[model samples]
Target: MYLLTLSESKPPNIVFIVADDLGWNDVGYHNPEIKTPNIDKLAREGVILNQSYVQPLCSPSRSSFMSGYYPFRTGLQHLVIISFQPVCLPLNISTLPQELKKLGYATHMIGKWHLGFCKWECTPTYRGFDSFFGYYNADEDYYNHSLSRVPFKGYFLDYRDDRQPVRDQDGVYSTHAFTKRAESVISQHDTSKPLFLYLPYQAVHEPIEVPKQYENMYPNIQSEGRRKFSGMVSALDEGIGNVTAALKQKGIYDDTIILFTADNGGWVSYYGNNYPLRGGKFTIYEGGTRGAAFIRGTGITGNRTYDELIHAVDWLPTLVSAAGGSVTGRDGQDLWKSISTGSGENRTEFIYNIDDDFPPVEGHAGIRYYFFIFFIIPMLPVLMGDYKLIEGYPGLFPDWYKPDTEMSSLDDPVEEFMAREGYKADNGYQLFNIKEDPTEHNDLSTKNPEIVAKLKARLEYYRKTFYVKPNFPILPDFAADPTKFNNTWSPGWC
Candidate 1:
């Protein structure tokens, strides 16, 4: 990989935009049904990553992106941190914003900050961002600015400005408000110092609410849920357009590095669609791990597709390297050359998931080395090059709730649909050449016992050596009850 020569001139401004629960086909570039002109423009002017992977869920993905390390290494491998959870990103560990802050950059974060907020020290402002304007929970009401967790009583206003709650923000559409905040930040930025703006928009997620204008934009969408979901995405797209326009108006668009990606795959129950890929959110399938990603900016080569494998953890080191900063002892690789120049693959190994439970199942986990993948959970799908082995069905398989039929339930209809379709799992270990069948419709395991044996052995080795018990104590469900744990105090990490 070629080292990026730091320009004698000022360092380029970095604008990192992350979308919440955006499906693979959610963008106009991937599906004509979705009207995402702003994101489409990025695809036209930058490189689209076809094989970008992230954690199966949001908090884990965000942690990996911020830390340049696997979730397992950071003690954030499991589920999302609930509101008031004592657990948080360890204070000793450095973050992307911290690195940028060290390089004389003005770091600002607008929108979601779901990593942790149990203590004031765990919030964005304390973790490297100079200013933070957004909510601190996994999700909040788009318009009311209130969290929706069942046990949390009353309207817990989640909107905040730097650390203080902004009670007046109620009734403001979060997507629009966040965009306006970003524009304000850009307009007020000190040009003498480069800017590191992180905009993680809460769009197309649950409680899909949109402005009336946006809601009426898609009259043809039969499913009301899907229609609302589309509206949320369109709103986000418009917000992106506004942000980019602000950058251009400031004469900094050409000098800014813009990286856009979804936090993870779509949550199908919420009308998010990851078509042509089996499984959705909360599974180890491609639908849960793979996401839509692109990078466009001054120094990047435009109008290209980079099929090289990349993980969420790679962004911290990659962006830090591009900013002329050093990132040592991180799992991420400086993929600046691979991403910008179409250079050969920069990452050959990826351990996507390592759960705390032994013989991980229902909760899926796995690892990939080059073209080989060893899925250690329910379905032991070991993929070596093009061929993949599946010992059984993923424990949590076929939640086949279709938008056309069971949209109202918002629950798994996979079993009913499977029985109706007369679908059956292969009796023994199954294999397929994914290169030829991206949909994984064919099985060739019985014919290739030797390959299966070799991969199984490798899987065993990984389980014994690479896997470790989760470091942090799992937060108890009582943590969600404000009365039981109302105090703001930092909890010790393992």
Candidate 2:
């Protein structure tokens, strides 16, 4: 029922950001050799979003953007929830900073809280984030912030300030201490309340450490891990140009909405590059769930390029319905009038990779409705509308285009590129119109066997009524329950 219209006496100021494994042509508006001029000036004032979509990893794309649901409905689909695990992100869900701190807004959160802290009510300031500094686990060490994994047997550290335990943030450089705590939380916000922040940024993830003055601004990047990952994406694009000049020096730059995405894609063994879109990060292909997005301040409207089809659980009901608030029973789709009138495409994405073990499911799943896109793990594909039915061979690292010294003896490049490209599941799929073959290299599933049996019966009816199970808690084997390691239960621990 929302068709866009807001300005309940000015409510803007959101900021968001994200960016961990970041790639899909590593910024500078999709690579001009990655300088990322402040995310290419927020993709030239903002809009871009060529096709968005996420959740190929990183705590299931941050638990589908803090629970607008769908990381297999919040069990956090599969990989990444590591350090101290007793599981999390289910304190009876309802986040997105507890619906923008119940609309009075000011809900902070600086950087990388790999979505679970084990206890203290699963951290992020007890889950609604009135403030949270950073690092809860999953990758740290940018100047000994610790955690290179030694989970319960000691050495964790993981830097924090809001929840304390901050050993004077050792040699800084966690993307310049999370962009100087997001420009000191936008220079001590409070301007009549209306600020969300949520930076994220564990820059170009990995121990690829930067700061040698951003590795002397990439000396002609000859690959020392892609010039330390283009100097950690040019120090996270100059800390997002000092957080958009601290929101235009706190006059709240055009009221401020911002966004900029990425939680997945780009990790071709860490020199990360989703070039010409294929497979990367943990593979759902289309370069690991098509990320590299955008949004930009206020009512949006800037250098355009929408292409609809958004996701990452539609930015928590499209920034809580662009701050006027109220987006009830949300599974994210407020998309603020299809991203401010760039026209419609509504939204229909399933995209999966389930496997915390529940119904003999192994990994990779898909759906996308209008303009079709079915898929199924053992290289199935599907796609429709711009055709694509593929049945194997999409490179989830078949020497992912080799050349990193032949990827160290090709250690299982998607099982030797599916047995040197023979991929047989009774050899049946291979169509491709990906709008004139966006590089699946033409096949046409044997000239459309009735659109591959009608997109494989709509991906088997969304895998039997929306793929179930996995409601959190699974990383147990703590060597036969060493008293289940700690945080057994929280959230008003009865």
Candidate 3:
């Protein structure tokens, strides 16, 4: 049963850097812009996962990354955990940090903790992270500490070492401060044990504000918001450079596996470019869901580019495998061996689930219940080819509703319907050979009915398994009887 004998094999230390709302083409390695020499160096010396992916938003992606389960499984879904909402993750699941802890690695998270707000179960400490700091809300003002979206009055600052809050400092920008805390944690942690650092930032998300020094770096950028974004990205790049240098200085650069990626596709409206792809955040389109993922250090090298289609859910199994831990129960396979040993090829086929709410299961409601059952709850096996079928209504779910609405409307229907059964597009269910069209420019639904049938079956299974239930008329009891609510009553997925 002891698959790994605790051999003297040095388990690689992990430093995961996740940028907030970064675009697919934001990094120089993807397409040169704004000079990221440090990140570029990582690509030059490491491997670029050309098709790595994450959730379309920040919190769920983070949840998926940490828990090694789809965000829906973790109950994060499309919703960002607000402080007032429950800060809980499902207790039955095992988290990546928890797995690493069993291997004697110290796990720490510095920066955004939007996965949970006040829920007792959702705290990072409870989820296997040994230490935590930063905001529980999705976005915060950079300099003034103001809440990004108004209506919620009076926002102050909070800093935490574990789950406990510390006095907020005046004049401190969240990004710079979080980075400094991370640097301090890295420098001061027990060096004898392996370390897992999950650093998710709040930079470039919203309320465009850059440190005065970084602000001047983008005078050449035309638009005001874009210039601010560029400045923020530059600062993040500098932070990476500093962090990597710190690793080198500590003599652990080669012993660590540093993974850098974005939580989702860019906000094109923010002047962010997800070039060659259609749509942006909140859509199931490639641009909104596809992301940047790369790995450097230890057994990974050569700056090789992989065209595999990977999702955020794979991180858990991949890291667990790389760390020589048990991943048999995990949803994802150990991608490390495949990528490193050349035994496996790039992944093909993927699903993008963007429903707003979580499906009612056992009469319970988590904010992300709909997302959990639909996208995150499904089995993800790599395909031999690039053919994928997307169920649910194809095309954009018009942003006609406010961002706060949990579900989208179908054709301005008087009532909401979670299940889009027997629904046929004029073009039929859209199909795409992603190998030929990663951008999804051409809809092959009309041309390929066979592919549609295959994908539709898969999609139907996905629906039957997860979204058979619906949201509650009232905020139903999530803990008592989650299955009492069903889609037949009032299923709403717009």
lDDT of 3 at 404: 20
Tens-digit lDDT string for candidate 3 (278-317)? 6555445666677876877776645577655567878888
Model 2 vs truth, CA RMSD: 21.8
Best by TM-score: 1
Identify the runs in model 2 with alpha carbons over 4 angstroms from their true place. 1-7, 22-170, 190-204, 209-263, 266-268, 271-279, 282-287, 290-334, 337-345, 348-444, 447-494
Model 2 Cα lDDT, one tens digit per residue, 25-124: 8887777867877788777776788878787778878978987777766667766676646666788888888898888898998888777765678788
Candidate ranking (lDDT, best to worst): 1, 2, 3
Give, for candidate 1, the lowest lDDT window spanning 10 residues.
485-494
Best of the two (1, 2) by TM-score:
1
lDDT, residue 118, candidate 3: 43
When summed lDDT is taken over every stretch of 10 residues in candidate 3, the lowest stretch is 361-370
Which wins on lDDT, candidate 2 or candidate 3?
Answer: 2
How big is the positional error of residue 433 in model 3, measured in Å on the Cα after superposition? 1.2
Ranking the candidates on TM-score from highest down gives: 1, 3, 2
Evaluated against the true structure, the overall lDDT of model 3 is 0.62
Clashing residue pairs in candidate 1, if any?
A: 400-414, 431-444
